[model samples]
Each structure stands twice: as structure tokens, then as C-alpha cells.
Target: MKIKTLAIALCLFSLPFAASANPTLLEKTRQEQQIQKTHNAEREAGFKLTEKEVRAKRNALIAERNRLQRETELLSKSFSKNENKLAKLEEQLRLETGSLGELFGVVRQAAKELDTEMAFSVTGADHSNYDAVVNEIVAAKALPSITQLNGLWLGMTEQIQASTELRQVSVPFINGEGHQSVVQAYRLGSMGLIADQGYISWDGKRHVATPYLKQPENGPSVSVMSQLNESGLQAVVVDPSRGVMLEQLANSPELKDRIEHGGVVGKIILGLLAVGAVIALFRGVKLMMIRQQIKAQLKNPTKPGNNPLGRVLNVYSKAQNRSVEALELRLLETIVDEQQGLEKGLSMLKLLAALAPMLGLLGTVTGMIETFQVITQFGNGDPTVMAGGISMALVTTVLGLVSAMPLLLAHNVLSTQADNIRNILEKQGISLVAEQAEKAGSAA
Candidate 1:
């Protein structure tokens, strides 16, 4: 009974509390609903304002696109109209120009020619402004101006005047040693440039002159040039082909340069020639001395000296008392011995002569082989690439021929002398035999 009363008391207390909680919950729910309504109203107003602003921006962008399109069309029509007008004007200009068009073409062509000519002309060193005027004419987009035409005339006139005038001036110069300096040089019209050295090459671009590495052998000497400078009437050598002949002459190889190009084969050939010359000289002198001794012995046959003829005469004297047949045999033996001495070096000389040409042929073959190798490795577009082997071939052949000729001639002359001596000895021996036979007959 007590537990039921406690439970009833607890229910009564919870009922009042539940009633109070319900009123408070209702008020709070109403307040939340009112706040949500205010938020919805504010969101709707913000959404409406954002929608109006987007529509206005879209309309403005569309209007701007249409305006740009209209402007593009107007500009395109104006461009077409201007293009037609320009074409009509150009056609009218062409019709009115008539011979003037041809004149413009001729003027441009002449300007181009002058520019090209002046680029290589030696007078360019003195007058360089002419090139600028001619270049303006060449590169002109419109018709040449009268001022430019006058300048062109003046340039041509100046070039002509300079070509006729011989002037001595201080100019930039490069010597053979490649040292650059300002030196007094004479401009030989358009032909060449002369300094203390011989002919010098002109550089039109740098406006400088450089001496040729090698001057022409037949060209004027320094003394002659100095005299010409001092005396205007003195004759000076000038290249008729302007600088072309001078350049060729300067680039041409000298004797020493040719030999160097000929390489080892040429040197060998030269060495062989030298040796052959020495041998020939020695043999010639010995043979000449032998011939002299033989001639002297002939003049006095009785007195025997230490020469071949003296020995032969002595042999004859010893054999005089013997039978004629025995004496003849002794004289023949002595002559044979003398013949051996006289013909000692003749064979060697002949051999050398024959060997020289053969060596030259060997060099030719080798040089040709080298040239073929070069051709195989590199195509023959440039002749200078093959010049080395070709030079060796030609120079060696020349050296061989030059060496062989003199050697062969010396051999021939020496051989003739030797043969003549042998003939003299044989004749003397036969005469001795004849005299001995006659004496024997007289005694019998």
C-alpha cells in the first residue's frame, strides 16, 4: 500500500512538470518558425536581385557583340574599296610611265652593274661613298630620286677620273710578314698597287693593300719602282689584266716551292744526278789525263814513264830481241791491259744514265698510285687536292730527264775518248810489230 502511494505522488509531480514543459516547447517552436520565415524572405529577395543583374549583363554583352560585328563589316567594305582604288591608281601609273618604266629598269640595272664593278675595283679604296649611293638605287622600292641619279653619275665620273689618274697616297698596307701599317703606295690607275716592294694586292672591302707573297720574277724591281716614283717619265711595269694576272703570278710556285712539292722522289732523283755528275767529272778528268799521257808518250817513245803508254813502250823495248811473233804477242798483251784501265768507269756511267730514267718511271708509277688513292678517298672536285701527287710525278720526270741527258752525253764523250785511246794503243802495237818484223827480215 505504501509503494502505490509513492508511485501516485511521483505521477502527480511529473504531470505538472510535463504541462509546464509543453508551453515552453510551443513558444520555442513558434520562435524558430518565425526566424525561418524571415530567412526565406531575405533569401528570396537576394535571389531576385541576382537574377535581375545576370539578365542585364547578358543583354549588355549581346549588344556589344552586335556592334563589333557591324564595325567588322564596315571595315571590310572600306578595305575592298581602298584596294580597288589602289589597283586603279597603279594601272594608271603604269600607263602613264610608258618609257619611264623602261628607264627605271635600265637605271636599276646600271646601278647594279656599277655596284658589282666597284666592289672589286681598286678605286674603291679611295672613294667608298659611291657604293652607298649605288646601293640605295639598287635597293629602292620606288622610282629613283633625281638626287640619287646625280650621285650615280658623279660616282661613275669619279671612277673614270680615278682610273685615268695615277696617285701616290698613304694607305693601309699589309706586308709579306702580315704586318699592317700605313705606308706610301702608288695606285697604278686601275691596274695594280706598288709600294717599296713590288706589286701588292688591294682589298676593296677593307680598303687596304697587301704585298704579294711572291712577286713576279719578270716584274719591275724596287729600284725601278723608286726611279719611277722619283721621275714621272720612268716606265713602270703594270698588269694589263688589272689584278687578275698579278694574283696568278703571286700564287705561282717558285723553283724551291716546286721541288718541295715534288717530295722525296724528286729529292732522290736530284741526289742521283749529283752523284752521277761527280762520277762523270772524275772519269772525264782521268780519261783526259790518260789521253794526254798517251800523246806525250807518243812524242817520245823511247823514254818510258809511269803511264800506260810508257809501260806499253817499255814492254815493246823488252820484247824487241825476241822473235817477231813473240814480240807481237807481248805488245798485244800490254795493249789489252791499257784498255782495261781506260774502260774502268765507262760501264758505271752508262749504268747510272740508264738507271735514272728507270727511277723516274718508278716515281711516276708511285705518284699515279698515290693520286688514284686520293681520288678514291676524296672526289676530284678540287685540283689542288691532287696537286701533290701530280707535282711529284711531273717534277720527278723532269728531273730524271734533266739528269739523264747530261749523264748520257758525258758517258758517250768519255766512251769515245776511251775508244780513241785504245785505237791509238793498238795502232802503236801493230807498228811496233811491223818494225820488229822488218828488222828481223833485215838481219836474216
Candidate 2:
């Protein structure tokens, strides 16, 4: 019984110790969780406090911004009005600074109008009294008003003065100074005066500067134009759109004479061609006569003569009683002689035909040499100057070919026909001789 009681007491005591140890561990865990909860609450309280302070600050900033915006609007309106008033005052001051003449000038320019029927007459005592004409224009009431004529007087003065200067200028551009310029001025002035006015009529009453007029005949004016022979050169008049400088052409002796007389080479070549044509015409007439004679001989076949076919026929007739072989030999000899006579100058004609192209080539070479000379002399090297030589060369070549080709053809055709006719005559002669020889033999 004692052992049982001791075991029971020990069991009871161990159970209570185990139970107490578990409760103590639970209590420590509860303490740690309480500390964590306290720390979280404190942190949350601190964050809420900071958020409230920020909200208050933001509200105050919004109120301040609204107040500033309102003030800025009021200032902008005030500045705009001040700026407008200042700009107006500045414009008024600038207007006061300008002179009355300048103001009148502006108004006149703005109100001026153009009228078409304005008369512009140019009258000067000779070419030297141009100032009188300008003074007349200045005094005329037909011009624009003075206020509106700010530049009008200056412009009119220049125009009339320039017109007079141009009229007094040298006629052609022969001299160096005031040559082309004077010519151009004269031309433009004449045109301008005509356009500004209605028409231009030169007063025949010239001043002492001009000589007396030479009255022309009432009848047809005789042109002392020598017929210029331009055989080698081909020329065509170019119709210029701008007016021709006819006055200069009329005045320049050298230029006028050149136009009228043409160049030496052209004249010489033309004379040569004319002579050649005359000779050819005579030859052609002679050839026609020869052809007629040949035609008559062909039709009759009985005309006896020393001519080419005629001689051949005569030889054949003589050998009528002889053997055919002997007659044929005689006929052959006669035909040969006739052929030589017919072909007398044929080689010369051929030589002439061949020489045409060679002459053209010579012309080409000479033209090129001239072109080179021009290049060497002035070195202007203008294609227009060089083109003259080139055109001459090409024209000569074309002329040569044109002349030679037809002549060569005619020579060849005539020679061939002559040869054929000669051959036929010889054949007839031989046949007649052969027949006669055969008859003689048979008779023997």
C-alpha cells in the first residue's frame, strides 16, 4: 500500500508541472502579439496626422493661386489699354514729323491718272537746240500736275534730251564712241516719240547743219544697180523682225557698194558659168544638127560620105565584087578610122567632167585656208565667221557634183550609143563583104 500511494503522488505532481509549463509558453506568445499590435496602431496614428497636415497646406495653396490669377487678369487689361494709347500717340508724332511737300507728294501719286491722247512734239533748231524743246515741254500744260509730277519733269527732260542727242549722234556705228549707243538712242527715241504722241513727221525744213536737198526726177527713179553676178555664192535676204539699219546701209559707201556689186569671186564664177553655158548651148546645137544628120543617114542608108557610118558603108559597097573576107577587112579599117574621128574630143569632155569635183575640192581647201586666216588674224573664233568658209566649200562641192554627174551621164550615154552604132555598121559591112565574096567564088 505504501508503494501504490507514492506512485500516485508522483503522477499527480508531474501532470500539474506539464500543465503549468504549457500555460507559461502561451502567456509569452500573447505578450509578443500585444507588442506588435501596439507598434502598428502607433504607426497608423502617425500617418493620419501627416495626411491631415498636408490637406490643410494644399487648401491654402489653392486659395492663394486663385487670388493671383484674378490679379493677373486685371493687370493684363490695364497694360493692353496703355499700349494702344501709346501706339496712337507715337503714330500722331510721326505724322507731325513729315513735311507738307512730302505729304502733298504722297497724295498726288495716289490720285494721278493716265490719259492716252497726250501730244508729245519734238521741235529743235537743228540737233544743237535740244534744250529749247525741253523748255517747251516744261512750260506746256499738257503734262501732269506739279505735285503729281515729282519724277515727271525729270523723266520728260531725259526723254526729250535723249531724243535730241540721238538725232545729233553719228549716223552709223562706224566710229568707236557714241556709235552703237547713238544709233540705238535715235531708233528708240523715234519709236518712243511716236508712241507717246501719234505719229512722227520729220520737218523737211532743216537747220544750217544740214545741206540743201537734191530734188529727184518726177519720173521713175533709175536704180544705178549693177547686176551682181553671184554664180558661186547663194544668197538670200533675211527679213529681220526688228527694222533694218537702212540709213546706215545707205550711208556706208563700202557696205553699200559691196551689197550692190557682190564679191569678185562670185562675179568671176558667174562669168565663167555664163561662158560655159553659152559654149554648151552652141555645142548642144551642133550636137543636135549632128543627130539630125545621123537620123537622116539612118533613114536613107544610101547617103555616101567620109563620115563614120558613111565611110563604113562606102567601104562595104566598094567590096561588093570582092571576096567577103577582103570586104570585111576593109570595113573594119574604115570603122576604126570613123570611130577615132567621132571620139576626138570625148576624152577632153571627160577630163572637164572630172575636173569639176577637183575644182570644188580646191575651193574647199581655199575656203578652209581663209577660215584659218581669220582665226589667226583676229582670233574672234566666232562660228558665224567660220561658217562662211564652210558654206562656200560645201556649196562648191554641191555645184561640182551637180554639174559633173549629169554631164558624165550624158557623155557616157552618147558615147555608148555611138559605139553601138559603129559596131552595127561594121557588122553590116562585114556581112555584105562575105556575101559578095561568096558569089564571086561561085562564079569563078
Question: For each predicted model, how many residue pairs clash, with residues at least 3 apart or on different chains?
Answer: 0, 4
> Tens-digit lDDT track for model 1 on 390-439?
88888778877887899899999988998999898888888889999999
What Cα-based lDDT does every candidate model obtain? 0.84, 0.51
Distance from true position, residue 365, model 1, in Å? 1.4
Per-residue error at 429 for model 1, in Å?
0.6
Task: Quote model 2's TM-score.
Answer: 0.44
The candidate scoring highest on lDDT is 1
- Model 2 per-residue lDDT tens digits across residues 176-224: 2323211211222332211111111232232111111221122111111
State how far residue 443 of model 1 sits from its true place (Å): 3.1
Top-scoring candidate (TM-score): 1
Candidate RMSDs in Å, in order, are 11.0, 19.6
* TM-score, model 1 to reference: 0.77
Distance (Å) between predicted and true CA of 436, model 2? 2.6
The CA lDDT at 403 in model 2 is: 56
Instruction: Name model 1 segments beyond 4 Å from true.
Output: 1-90, 218-230
Query: Per-residue lDDT for 283 in model 1?
Result: 85
